[model samples]
Target chain A: MDKPLNCTIKNPVNLTLGDIKVDMLCGCKVVDITFPNIMSPEVGEIRFKNFYVATLTVKAKYRTENTPRHTGDQPKWKTCLKRVKLMPDPHSEAGSHDYISLTSRQFRCELSNITGLRLILHQPSPVWREFKLEELRLFRSAGGPKTSPLPTWLLEEPKAKVQKKTVQRVASSTPKGGEGGVPDLDGLSANLQQLWALAEEVSTSQTSQSLGRFEVDGCYDINLLAYT
Target chain B: MAAERRKAIPSTSDDNKPLDSDKQFLERTNVNAVVRDVLGKIIANRPEDPVTFLADYFEALVEEQSSLVQRALRVITMTHHSRPVFEVNVRDSYNLLSKHKVNKKLKGVNGSVYTELLQALCRNLPSSVTIKLVQKLECFEHEAVPYDVFRSSIFACCVLREYAFIAEQLFASLDIQKIGKADKALCDAVMDQLKTALGSSRNDVRRIIESSYNLAPEGLHQALERALSREQTQGVCTSEHFITEACDSFLAKVKKLK
Candidate 1:
């Protein structure tokens, strides 16, 4: 398996902040839209034509392998994977209760196939074939996002989870550069209330992002063009 | 001189105040000396008294270690201003820069200073990996090897926000081998008379063991003989049932050996 690139697409790629798209707390994205037909076997020269964009995620995934045990390197004759409880929320969708320290990392995700591929990055770096991919789609356009650049504020620590009470109290006192900087408090308050008052649908259903479930639906074996 | 010192206690009467002041001065002097000595040792001997250093370190955070209640009082009352100036004489008569940084944030609330400091001291605790490495060191396996009180105090943290790993590392420091010993008979007697630890709160786990006299998994008795055979080979002569039923006894033997 090829090294799957850890991509970070501000999950809600274009969080519509009034008129412009503001990348939320989500990480950068490397997206490519293609016919899903071709698998780039060759890490080739970057020509101007084969450019595409795909949504990205900065998920923690792992690839691992076992090594030949040199009886000398390890302790006496003992071999055990130290186990620890799964952290944070036990029922979190992150999966795996307590992760065991084996010899490798672990986590997996998928990306969808769409046309009009572009790289929405934390920093504007030209997207090329540097990402080691097991299987990847090609793109036609590397047209960057329409947003003005990620304002310096979004890159900071997890924004304080402002509650209604907190919003009321801190609406003024909150440190300058509050999440997404100068977030429309009125808009935020409304979204927050809507999120809280599920009333009926709380038990049965929610949108994929709402439920914290995401998959970039990638389709394969369709004729796709490559844009460097 | 010894007799004079003993007799002095009775005649001193009002000297209690002065004696306490002198004792405080002496302890303060001793700390400066110990730290200078410890710093020298930390440089020369290299990390010998890290835990002792850690203990003494966290101890000073205690406004008063007279007892739990007094320490608790300090927790809520020890003001931020006090913590910075708390280690006044720590400056000592010697040493260039006071390299030791004080946590100006430590708020002392009267009696709870000890507890609060204990919590804050976790900030300085050895990493879990570092602690494990130390535990594995032959030096740490000795008869006088110190237990980490920092690890012990975390049990008080129930919100369980963080530090669970630190909690486990602290609890595992309880040496069963140190508590159980060769003189099983004598150890059992003392253990029987003793009560549970002052801080050991009653919880479901305690209730489970108390209700059934079963401390481990159910249906362990049937496998005791086979289990004991393996355990005995490892120098632990214990049936599953015997060990569970007599944990206090086991701990006593280990403690006695120490």
Candidate 2:
């Protein structure tokens, strides 16, 4: 979502990967998820601001972060990483391709209508790493494009600094667990470090309850692999 | 009439001597009547430690006078008035209560504890019971339930959030066919809550909406979809708006996910 997508995501799409165990949310506290989508159906109709959009196939992989311990007695957890992909339903949008290569490679949907688009955008797609503009190319769609050293989106990179934590627990209380203390960076992930900056902003918002936490352990792993 | 002691206790007067409202207790033949008596007492007594009194009240029941034990509980739980208070005071009593099954056979007799507990369960009421009421007010559909059961169902839904199996059991008890179609109130609640909490930024709105959309219906779901669409224009939701954004983002992600 930070960069321009090549295609339009006009409609809602349902694409799935593995072990997700999705269910149609049922009853009282169960939130409503569109039945078709919940059942892993192929069609989607997304609307924003009361405007109905097109339907497509949207595949997502659920991701999280927590460097799972490689061995036991260490008590580890898997930080699921997810990447989302958007494509025109091949059944609906494409035919047997004369160009084998285009057909073989998966499609990326670039939404032409950006009026009211919402992608959680926190995580990246499996195809995302491939989409990074590494060399910073400035070419137009048909190759008759203007050249520039920096792409249009570049403003200024912020100054980078290493921050330190003076985690002073209450003097009276002992650490909660057996491994009384954690290595400072053991649970920290790149995304969490970023959220830490957001946490600073939350403290200034004048709210009674602290909605955001300084806990970087879970978020880091999810964001690291997904948001990168 | 009877001051017969079941077990030895210090406050013999409160236990043995009939309360000023003894006439009402004598008239109580079923659980609802007992519930009315206990609720009236709690509302009137308004004791800081009603739970303790309730426990003492239940423990004081004798074999012949055992009706008092279940009767007092019936009064505490029915009408949804003092159940929480009762639960808090006799915190362990909830476990005991959930385990007890009310027998339906005893109705007109003096010791109709069975009929009493059943009536006190707040079931078969004509109006929509709260527990079932909320369940029936669906983004989808739910019904076939009662108030106390509905209240517990909501909590049950929340508690089983991490487990799929538990979620299934929670759904099974719902008044599914009775629940209506999508609701606009959900949309209003979500949008209003988000706007109040996170401001009008599109990204912030989306985060806010997503935060509550899993619990919304109809137009609010529409609003959330709108918020998600606005992300590109406003930029991804910033951390300052994380509260609204994180949840909206998660909900949108889960829905669009394959």
Candidate 3:
């Protein structure tokens, strides 16, 4: 759709520790990119320029009360993607410069309350002189329509439903037609009413069958497994 | 002999010290040896019900000199002395893979079955092993994979993990006749990749390989040399094929030690 890139990146938070813009990351096995005190509830997509790495593993850390803790800090680091091959052939220079986008669906855990991301870059061959990803960015939306349109039935008023019921009652009171080719609408409405009554009776019987008690009418000697 | 053994029972009035007659009875019946043998079987098998196990044990003892107990005892002793080495039972792996219902006309296993087979086989092994194996197979895009591909992919993973002993056993169990050939250049290339992947843990992997297969330092070197130099074929060697040959050579070295 040729949507604009980085349009939803509001207030890109810097590193929690340092202020350096460009760092020499040669010979480094692991690098971390983090955003401190992010206000977004969820991240829609993440994109980064690839470097000379055979395999790039993406791990995410988030703060969650649902996860139990024994002796650690409030939010702990957890693994998301154990291994992701960014550059298929590390020895070759084909896909080394391409930008890779990881959507929220790709992440193993929920992308909310995300504190940091760890990028583990590995080059299985020693031929690469330098390796590091660049231009890392996270967006709140993927530049597509957020939700589908509501169905037409959901937008109708309550008066329409009352009109439908009144039409069915009128059809049921009408007499049969003389022409044999025409279908009987009166008989059809009567059968539909009978079916609806049967369904309601079954549902009420199910609800009344259970009393949530072990004894029947205060008699503890009753056999629970008895059929009748 | 039974009469003589029974006569040695001591009186209840005596304390912990066994009388001479009681000692003689125990010695004649070999009570210690019999008890040790039975207990060893019970511990090794670990049945759900101990009382039922004991009843069956006594029943077996009555029917021909307790040969079953002696066999079970042998298994226990052998396992105790050796490291619990992994064996690739292809029949068992195939049985597990085939248990999931799939279309016979498809001529391959379902993708979920393939993943489950890898997980089941790689249990107790490193998680990286399964991850690497899945990536190496490159069959995630396919709806189904042939049986041969699955077998070879598993072997490739073991080789990558430096599990030469396991890889070698899997080769034999899968009845793989020829993994083609690799020249010295191919071996050197594959080894370089492995060295880079392992990084500082290369020595640690070597130590593990040595301990698991009981290989000496010089013996491992000799095996690698033989595997690289002995091949004369000019066939194109993939990384997996080269590693398999190296593991086979390691197995050959182990067999020589025995």
Candidate 4:
């Protein structure tokens, strides 16, 4: 919605992409989407929800940091996907609100470090007045967290800091099956650990109370207060 | 009663002579005052089933007579009044839904519990809001329903009444971080659709209220349609402001359509 769209029918075309009057729109339009600082995702894939487009072409501008020539330079747009058929019928309500996912596997170029995306939408039907890509979102690869970068172990190259001969590996002894052995209790809190240690003693001393007898101390004859 | 208790305890020891220890036991127990309080309630309320009432009363008394710290905490948390208090809002509904037993993998809760929660929450809201909410629930009495069904129904209730503020609060409370931002984005997208639809034919709104509120006689739809057309003719901007105004006019028409 950063730039105004020249809609054919509506005087002031709706800027929001959430909902668009399908009948009002005519011919082809190229929409450039620049991500805000908060959600400027490194593109690994794209998902389109509730779309009714005949064909969609995708282009990406990757924010390259390694290259000195690309720094502070104009966006070098590269077409990653070309003329993918989203829906068989753009005019009909069939597949009008279908979800579509375009992964890096479908794209020709690597979708790393994508800061911006361009969608070329082509629809040539006058029958519908309300059509829109109800939602558009970018996501990182499934191998790592979507919002955060890859784990350090995965990203960083291996370094052989320790000498192999000096390294000592301690082998844990097998636990005894009998009552005395302290079993390995993983993920238990310190309080829970102490409780587990005391459980045997506690169970031995504990006794179930008499269900029928309701008494004050040992006295059966006593006045009881009314319940509120 | 203390004198009587002293006599009763002495009879268990020696027949004629009363022991000093038996007298002390009677004095220590404070039996008379407790009996008096119970008698006072029995006389006042005059419950039909005295034994059952006494059982419940004693059970509650035992619970209240816990440790001093526990009693203080109970006082802070529990309502002092005898009657249960009801809250009329989506947050309360959300809290109830969350606390209800659910199978995590299946994403479903007991359907009856869910319906009861919805009914309790919508008790004080407008009839139109409640009816729409009930219809949107789409949950059977005995079958289990997915978690999102409850969330969407609550949102529908808020939207029908144009309580956008409450809807936002509801969204914030029920939002699952694991699902990422898509759920919230979809919610916003749908709300935006409603706002946008208000400008055009208002067919969406008409479709929504096609099944009118109870007591909203026939021609209620026509009246609402006329109101919407009149509002449009007056040139109210078809944006966020118009949505609010349109909802108000729509509600007003519903009220007077009879």
Candidate 5:
């Protein structure tokens, strides 16, 4: 028996409301999970060589407040997959564990084709309101006589794509007066100078309070935002 | 000099009156402060039975200050422990208020304090209590009560398996047209509950469905008929059962009325 291929989501994978960017009250959606060894051998084929079953064991700890105030100490877990088909494992009859086996071709195809896994937090018990992803392990086993260690090739972690920023350099030279360049003021006419002088005189006179002054009253003025 | 001296002397008239006495004057003068003070004390002390204490305090306030009472009630009911007491207090207050038409007096308060009380009471109250509240609520016209409040009360009754109460009190008495206009979700919820009740083999389902036929709006009757027919066609319903007979009789009655 080959030791199961295990993948761990980096700890504290906080589920968030995508638009508001706030922590989810009850559920999480894990997307783009790629298991290295389980890739289709052929480009479009849905079959995987020696694929049997994947056991996902999640050890989750919920937020303290998630437990109902009435129920003391005993925190009930009501977390479940929203879309994934999970069945009770017949092999492990002793312990209570959720299992999903790719025993059939359709199930294997579904598993291979899914883009993401969504987990929903159900009701009755409020204990599943918020939970921390403590440990997540996926164990893959092929039907065999002897157990072997999970292949190192399948354990290679996916690399995160880093964004590269490109810097733009400004042009080296400044243009002299020409098309799309600064206008030259040296060629001003006498009539234009007279008009400019008059405009400057009016601006100066306006700043000196040549306009009539109106009496300002403080009473009955309302600040709309003030409650009083 | 005399005017200045008179201004210098602080008015002791406000001090002479009992705190709750001259409620109208006090409310006009410092209603917010009084409300805050009362709320502060209630929150700080965390009484053994806050709902009753708050209700008593609210009653002391003049009717003009009913909003403050509503606020206090909202606060008390929001907590987990005070729910049972809140239900009892609400029932008493609703009865008293209904006798005097308090919801009408506080019409400016938006659906009145009765609506708020109903909404709060419906949140996880026992079906028995919910039925009583719904009956009391029926005193007001369908337009006066908020659709959500009415829906929640109905939903509570349904959840408690009091389908008969829903059929007789709500479905029969409510303005089906207004409910349809105001909140289609509520109408759908009612229909769903009715269907669920009708599908069951419980001894009461027959009685409940028959009563529903008597009180159900035309649209609801039609919906029920369609649902029953669908179930019948699928061979899921046996003719010997009460549901089939009830459906046939209801459809016949509806056709006769038309």
Candidate 6:
């Protein structure tokens, strides 16, 4: 991987934007957004994941005086706002938004790796006007259904001899999901059970690999050899 | 014992021959593995014609092994090792993928292959090659170059120090409001470098100051004012006199333009 894959949640998540404050000025402006932490009951801690979609239900109206002049040609006035953009970073490309009229217009956006959402309002007319945001919501889809749990190989004893046995157990097991389930001590000989217990103990005790020997002189020799 | 030994010797010999041939065939045909190995070699040797050899070898698999293009690109970038050869490989693979419509499979920000390609170029290739790559990227109508990649190129210019003018040009081209928090930090870092360059060397301070002004005009003015005030407090006539003079002239010009 070029960089570490972002930590993600396996379940769908949502955030309500009722209390967040938005600051705006006359002419073209932007709305400020605040994102809340998504807590998982299963993980028993706060889980942070990028949102997949943002839905904004807003009520806004353009001042009639700010409307564009109607020339003999087509009326240049925009009944709806133009260039409505939603983005996480101030610099990134604005996510998708649909242009609609003044009463309860819903704007949906698909964005990834965003901490907060910012709204950019582009109005052609140079008139000062106020825009109201009635509601906003953020949603994230589950990372697909949880697959079968991680293989037992990762939890196996790390000793070379026991590792070989663990691989054999994993490979010989059928896809039926019960072959590696419970070790039947009732069927196994006492000696085999003792051996298995010993292997597990050895594997768990060593948690990591031993640091290998190092020789500064050997490294110096190799460096010198490269020049030669 | 003698019969067993006789059987083992022939069996071992037969196994070794087939294994070697099978390994050779796989190495020659497996497009992903071959591309990865070639990328590694390019980093080490920087061959002249990186794309041609791979292109010819995978002429048949070009259509079949289309999925491997992302992997190949990932290998090039993830290794954090780059060369002219790797740059060509990345461009050629990107083209091939686009031709086959394999890029449709990519998702989200990761799908910005143009940005990834440019990032690799900025990190690995020479300044001239990176400049050319950026030019090529700008010409594409469908692909909008990511600001992170642009920021990285600017950072690369600062590190190279020879291409300060390119950094200036980049700062001027970008929209100030579109600069992200990370991008803002990079802008500040580059400006700091420019300030150091101005104070120490007899280089053209006008261009550097102009670029900084273009990047953040108000910020630059505030910084200059702060620096001038700080200098006054110190009560020392240092070499910073010329920088202050240059800033004054640039600020005056900006006022005239307004």
Overall lDDT per candidate, in order of appearance: 0.27, 0.29, 0.47, 0.44, 0.34, 0.34
- Supply the DockQ value of model 2: 0.01
lDDT tens digits by residue: candidate 6, B1-258: 654455454345545553234444556678559678766655654445667645643554456543444544443442222343434544444444343332567432223444454445455434444544344333232343233333333223222222322333334322233232113333333345344433322254444334333223333333333343344333222222322322322222111100
- Candidate 5 Cα deviation (angstroms), residue A195: 83
Tens-digit per-residue lDDT, B38-96, candidate 5? 78757754666988867766765646555543554444443333234434333433444
lDDT measured at residue A156 in model 2 versus the true structure, 0 to 100: 22
Please report how far candidate 4 places residue A151 from its true position, in Å: 29
DockQ of each: 0.00, 0.01, 0.00, 0.01, 0.01, 0.00
Instruction: Quote model 2's TM-score for chain B.
Output: 0.22
How does residue A41 of candidate 1 score in lDDT?
A: 21
TM match of model 1 to true structure: 0.16
- Residue pairs with backbone overlap in model 6: none
> Model 3 chain A, poorest ten-residue lDDT window?
A202-211
Q: Is 2 or 4 the stronger prediction by lDDT?
A: 4
Angstrom error of the Cα, residue A40, model 2: value is 70
The residue-by-residue lDDT of candidate 2 on B1-258, one tens digit each, is 433332233344656774433344455545556567667757754666789756654555433455443644543442232234543433323333433433464222121332233333423321222233222222211112222332332222221121222222222222123232212332233334333433323355344433332222322233433443344433222221332232232122121100
Sequence-dependent TM-score of model 4: 0.24
lDDT digits (tens) for residues B1-258 of candidate 3: 755665655445558765456546667788867778778756755556768777776665667653322323223222211122212233334444554555555433556666655554445444544554454344442355555555444444333333533333322322223443334443443343233222222245433332222122222233333444555634454434543454333222111100
Give one digit per residue, the lDDT tens place, for model 4 in A90-201.
7777766777777778988886656667777766676655455645656566322333444444333222211221121111112222312111112112212222222222
Question: True-contact fraction for model 6?
Answer: 0.00
After the best TM-score superposition of candidate 3, give how far the Cα of residue A170 lies from its true spot, in angstroms: 42
- Kindly list the per-residue Cα lDDT of model 2 for residues A1-228, writing each as its tens digit: 022222233332223344437742211110112222122222112222211111222232221233334343343222111222222332232321211111101324332211222232111222221111011111112212213435422322111110111122222124223321111221112222222222223223212322123445446465466743
Candidate 6 Cα outliers beyond 4 Å, as residue runs:
A1-228, B1-9, B12-69, B75-82, B100-258
CA displacement after TM-score superposition, residue B180 of candidate 3 (Å): 55
In angstroms and one decimal each, the interface RMSD of every candidate reads 28.1, 21.0, 37.8, 31.1, 41.5, 34.6
Model 5 lDDT tens row, A1-228? 344443323333434556546644433423223343443311111112211112222222222354346556554332222233232332332212332232222222323322222223122123334332222333343233122344322222111100110011112112221222111112212212222222222222221111122325434347534675
